[model samples]
Target chain A: MENQEEHQAEGVGRPGRPGRPGSNPEAVTARIRARFGDASVRDGNAVGCESVIAERDALLPFMTFLRDDPELTFDYLADVTAVDRLKLDEAVRFAVVYQLYSYKHNRRFSVSIPVPEADPRIQSVVSVWPGANWLEREVYDMYGIVFEGHPDLRRILMPDDFGSYPLRKDYPLHGKGERDNFVF
Target chain B: MGLEDQLQENVMTTKVDAMVGWARKNSLWPMPFGTACCAIELMATLASRFDLARFGAEAIRFSPRQSDLLVVSGRVSIKMMPVLKKIYDQMPEPKWVISMGACASSGGVFNTYTLVQGVDQYIPVDVYIPGCPPRPENVIQALMKIQEKVAQAKAN
Candidate 1:
């Protein structure tokens, strides 16, 4: 019991430690191992979640595989959001995260794709998930990332004439005096 | 009891301006442009608990053309400013605006990009009710103040 308590204190758990009740982490981990190798997959630090870091070029193909493969079908595109990691001391300045879920398997996984600061552009996944339309537009509106080939790509939250992306680290919390010029 | 006798008995001496002012003050139709938590308190003021009808301003009209008083009772975001201004413009002449709450009068706690500093910058305001979410009593008092202003209006 003391040794078990020490292990808990050290924050050490066995490989493939069970996650949330409904989620079958073992199944997701096994499939990721068989397909993308162990290097591509990691325990997401968050319990009940697993992380898969996919290459930019392989993003669409991997997402397609995850959706089509019967054993690891992550059919639900829960959300598409981005994090502005400008001051986090990371090589890739932006990280676009895709939260996915498998209704059939009753499991969930998160895929994060690191994007660089310069020429931030990514392939539009609307063809794969129609729901990604507005979500991607919102990401673009906030992060200023271009989702190439996004049909009707426009600002969803901010005004069309709004210049700066509000969510970026460089943008001011009080705004850039643009809101003052608005004629009511 | 001929026409000459009836005219002397029925005629009463009163100023035309005073009569007009009396009508304006007693029959103020309010437009409640409530958008936040203050809206709930505004509703309470209108409800039986506070009974706003006693002031003769209980007729809550959503259409700006039908209302003479705009009871702005919450934070007004920048995006919402244009709409608020348009509604104010649509209100008939001699209309008064009551900014009810900290957010409405001075942007309250949300001194941020999305919120306007104060609604008065966008539209003319008559009464500024000071409170985070002013109690129903405060709303009643503001209404009384508007009634005073209406009573003092001059006829052209």
Candidate 2:
């Protein structure tokens, strides 16, 4: 346990055998493209990776690929976050995010979406990752994005009676609660 | 854990009494349950400026099993209570908890069903640090108070 400085990423401190290695993300992407012939797979602009894509119809299948692939071993869903894409007049007003972690691979990946502002609806990934329950709720609570198949979706970070998502472009963070003075 | 054992060890039966008296007094591991902005201040307290390491409390375990103090640094929700309790249950006893910031101490500005008024309703709390999101200095003060409480315990 000494010389943690020499330890690999995530530090193999937990017991019961070391985890799996990362699958070729390109291969995974290839599977996504093969599965969904009609949809466009657009790469992500986020850090650590340049090739992460959003295949509109095959997102669930892509998720399944990440989770079920023995080589990929994305067994852990670390976090789910969402952002309002309002400032940019894009196709969707909201973007729901999913962070998938593979202890075996010692690498992580993220899946995201651009939900239409009008409907603000999309299929849920909770079935794919149970941890999505809270993250999805948070997304709903913050960005008003609804997961179509979520078991139970309600306001998470915000009060039940409160209106509007605080994280949205126009939503004033200070005005949501009475902590206006604390912002300083 | 037993009275006889307490007498044999010449220590308080409560894990609280023994640790504060003789061994590992300085190394108080904190379990931070951060949900909002207050978490930032708690981090600041642990960072270089305040250096919580000075108090031998720099090791904050995310897992409750190894943690001695649970620092509820921000907002808590009714839904999150079960997870919090589950984590608390895993922690070894004679443990301490610091309810940091107004949100954790008294639900801050979230006066609604979504946010719990305080962590005490479900879990035991030792110290309450108040501020909308308490400054890092306040967190240091709270740590000092916990240290005081630990130091004043009657030896078994």
DockQ computed for model 2 against the true two-chain complex using alpha carbons: 0.04
lDDT of 1: 0.83
lDDT of 1 by residue, B16-126 (tens): 888888888889999989999999999999999899999988899999999999999998887788889999999999899999999999989987777888899878899
Model 1 lDDT tens row, A1-184:
5643443443432223347443445556567667777776555544457776666766677788888876666789999999998888889988888888877555667888888889799888888888999999999999999998799899998777778898999998889886577754
Best by TM-score: 1
lDDT of 2 by residue, B1-156 (tens): 657765895654556566554454587899998988889988888999989999999998888888888898888765566677888888887688899888888878876535667788778899999898888888888888888876666645
Cα error, residue A160 of model 2, in Å, equals 1.7
**Candidate 2 lDDT, tens digit per residue, A1-184?**
3322222233322222222332334443454456554265665766663235474455577777778865456789888777777787676667777777777656566667776778788778899988888888988887787788899998876556566676767876445442321111
Docking class of 1: medium
Given candidate 1, what's the lDDT at residue A16?
31
